[model samples]
Target: MTIRAAHFTPEVLLEAPRRSEATPNSKGSLALFSVSTYSFSEHKRQSELRVLDISRNESKLVTDSEDASNPKFLDDNLITVLESKDGATNVLIGDVNDFKKTNYTAGTIDGSVDDWKIKDVGKGKYLIAIAASTQPDGTLYNSEKAKKPVTTGRIYNSTFVRHWDTWVTANKNSIWVGTLSKDSKTSKFALGHFENKLKDSGLESPIPPFGGAGDFDITDTNLAFVAKDPKLNPAFNTKQNLYVIKLDNGSSPKKIDIPGFEGATSNPNFSPDGKKLAFLSMVQNGYEADKNQIFLLDVEQSDPPKGLFTTPDNKGTWDRSPSSITWSNDQKNLYVTAEENARVKLFSIPLAANSTNSSFPKAVFDEGSVASTTFLDSGLFISSSSLIDNSAYHLVPSSGAPKLLSSSSRSGSSFGLSRSQVSEIHFPGAKPGTTIQAWLIKPSFFDDSKKYPLAYLVHGGPQGAWEDSWSTRWNPAVFAEQGYVVVTPNPTGSTGFGQELTDAIGGEWGGLPYQDLVNGFDYVEKNLSYVDTDRAVALGASYGGYMMNWIQGNDLGRKFKALVTHDGVFSIPGQLGTEEIYFPNREFGGPFWENKDAWNKWDPAQKTENWATPHLIIHSEKDFRLTIAEGLAAFNVLQEKGVESQFLTFPDENHWVLKPENSLLWHTVVLDFINRKVGLKAYSEQSETAKALKESALSG
Candidate 1:
């Protein structure tokens, strides 16, 4: 007898293995990566470090410890990784071949380490650069500060009183460079002393919240980093400048000047010879979604170190914004990844002098979305994923086609997923000349003869798009497997199509983008016969959440059976509650005081009379970006309007629900909400435990 596998569910999506980007050796013959999986049965997560042999396309386990992370290649045979020791981050050095047998603790620092980089200068001498939080007194900052100076109130005179999820404090993230003297007798390394790179500058390198080692680069003689301009107010400014300092001399940091470019800088990379630097920059001062242009700097070794900054001559012709930048091993070309249409593709830009204005970036790899790339002597090492696939690795050689190195799930049997169930489509946009792209997903056991409810998902960022990518949160697959024909539409403000489309939503937030969503819904109703529009539901987060509120007030609100919004805006004037004040300013053309009509034109709070749809509102208390008040206001309105509504709050989470247990509960509640409203219960085959929870949710 043959027993079929269970359909794809929230459990399958969350428990599947998550793989990190692969780090290649100097020769590019071997790569190191990690895989982590959560076990519901054990209520824990297990991680393993693996080494991949490129020649044979095989991988072997190196370690399975959960403590190890941020692995980097020190040499062809050596590696350095971060591990937790005595409640502090410690560096461990070991051979890649036999890590357990030859590993030893290299050094431990005082504070929490977010990222670290190591360079072997020569002959028993090395430099270790650690990116950690540093206090004004030059000591590393850690969790100890949480318990000391127990002040019940926090005082602030600046606009950035809070950001993202943390309260603004005196501590800033800076790079600490220290010398590691190797003991020749025992072959062990000891850390001597440390120096704060941005001591008194009142600046931070590797900007707060999400910056890491990529924000700075180090070579044998000099260090280059990007820091937010200290003069600008962080709450309303999006400017990050570049600086270089001499490692051998006690010289002050020199700001690298890019005359016309003044927006933001990221991913500083030094050439192999350490004579030139390459990075990505944006041109606008306040816009965070500006095009990322590639820039280069040439350094002359002289007193005060003369530096020349220049952008690519073809920058004016390159329409796509590069998300990441990397120099080829030979320094003749640069590799970058950018979103085109609806896919993130890797392209090669030649640096030859003969390159003409017609020289556009040539796409080398366009299979799935390229998450990250590691430039290698052979070619490029890529980590990518798609709507059905979770993780895959490929090597695009210098001359030949790309070769598949490894895949997280090679077959649908692994998690009951199939590429056939995923598809893409295009339809007429809100305007005549524009077109909208959407990804349509069907259930694993889809029956075309049966009608399925429509799951309409709007993406955040307004500048963001729904790509041919896989995600654990708000996964279209999870919705599809539960008897829905999920449709994710990229409307007017969605990126990847071009800059024009992405910029169209500014100041017209609730105008054209909302029309595009209505057009998309209408298209599905008339075109996709398998979808039951009468049983449709809409959901989104951030800008998408804002759209849900917008839809609730507009004529589109009557078409949906239910709506789910996470961390969304309730009123346009409510922008004052956001931490990134500049975001609303750039989008609406100015602050509410300066642009009264524009701010109130699309206010959802003013259109509360039409709010009759059932809504599920989810918001985190720590999400300073949108703040908890926005969610509370929306829920209050829904309740006062006599609408079916439920508010779910996570005090420990931020804008996103990242904790494993919380994510499970989130998915369970969300699925139950939509399913009950759509006149279906998709989890009938679940165990008694899940049924009890679903019943409890219904009762509540």
Candidate 2:
């Protein structure tokens, strides 16, 4: 059964890093970044929010709020921010020095705040707001208490929680935020345009098909604005489209339609003079339109979006999606980065007046790593650990390729035994000759003489790599901090190596590659003296879930103590026709009706009778990929056979929990479950864990 790439549980695609930050200041300068761990429990990506000094590579800790987000760097002293803990939102103003220490809570008057923002009316006066949690219509507000609040962005403290409309930026008083759009399930529009207005939980909010239907940004001609709608239902791509809105005072939005590009447009930036807008689009998907482009949109013309270079020139019609496009001071060229091979490949576009699409985009430099592009004055900024320096960068004008910038890295910080660090351990991989380079993070203050318990980490992406990234939710740090020896092996079919390694599992489901993972675990036991072979658990999401199913079907062993699958696929056949996304269809190349055996053998459902692992299934309600039913099917099978298992589904989260509060809460539950099942003392519930949570709240 062919599955659309989107439907493959998304664990692999998710492994690739995602980035977000406020717009650059007047001089195109942003030397510092306020980052937080905004991620879901289902994937293995970096998670944490902190103010990183771009120049020094230093960081100031923010509250451990899963929803710690909406940061505006107004000057250097003051910053406007939104913090949500429980179900309310709190907007605050602070000098950069004491921003972390400021009192933050939801609501404007008192008690918990519901919503907020910082508005500067261009002059000198600044306006801050605290709105009611309930929308105008009277339904519950978009918070923890709502029906299902999607953990949209930031890691607000554990108590803070917001719905899909978690973050937004606009001109202080006018409230014209050209970049963000707040849409609800009932077709409600918070940022002017909404297609499907979802029911509001708090008061009453306006339904979509909102006030600004086609475009926004109606005030400055110099500023180019375009809003792309990913459709009322993001899980399905067919409903999505792109729109370009020119921000001129009193000018209505222009819904420019690109003839061939079907998917949504992402991260559109403009030239210094605002004469041109550069953006990227996924174009078409099912067949072979993985290439994204750095299209040049003429703000002077009508629907004049020009497709530049199709990336990887050799691969089908691949496109290098230019993300975070920025113009250099000289205006002689544009500094941008394109995403390639799951990581970002940096590039440059010249502003030569006489050059065509072929001449302007001259290849200059590429890190060939998973880095998110940003800018800091003359140089470009990137957020990635893939580089040798962990947090290094490139200085555009003076650089050759890209230099590692991080001078000092606080490599030693633990959340107790719940989060640990294990470096430089190698294991045997799928085949005997292949070496599985890995890391085994153990509990803090671990007793080496004694054999400690071990929790196996199954990375989600079949093509994804197991890299070192930080997170408080389902964090490897948690296991090490909590005292368990967590094993993460980059078995065969993992990325970071190349596409050959990634495509290894493309057509093979329950074949040798899957066995390679099991073998990798065995290799760890046989090689690493630090790992306790006796205690182990099979854990993963997406395709990793597929492996877990394979293990259960084969009745591998009683060696595994517990199993966890987050947004995984249980039945390939069922997933093809049923999933919200068409990923299975695309991957497998056809419907299950045409290829029955391939569907059966490739599916973990067929081997249900041989299941044995004590499994835990986590399903994100907003996950557009492998629907919740797939997880439920696994639960039913495990339960019917009397196999020990539990299922926890987050009704308010998406494929990934992009909020801090929920992330903290999520990590808490997962760690607690693992600790309890693994025969570890539940001391964390009373001491270490509680203290960590509290500290995160106070600091974050």
Q: Any idea how many clashes model 2 has? A: 109
Report, for all candidates in order, the number of backbone clashes.
0, 109
List lDDT for all candidates, in order. 0.83, 0.51
Work out the TM-score per prediction. 0.94, 0.61
Scored against the true structure, residue 147 in model 1 reaches a CA lDDT of 45
lDDT of 1 by residue, 242-295 (tens): 888888887767887776677888888887778878788877888888877776
10 residues in a row with least lDDT, candidate 1: 302-311
lDDT per residue as tens, model 2, 608-655: 888887787777766645667888889889889998877766677766
List candidate 1 stretches off by more than 4 Å: 1-5, 56-58, 144-147, 301-315, 353-358, 411-413, 682-700
True-structure lDDT of candidate 1: 0.83
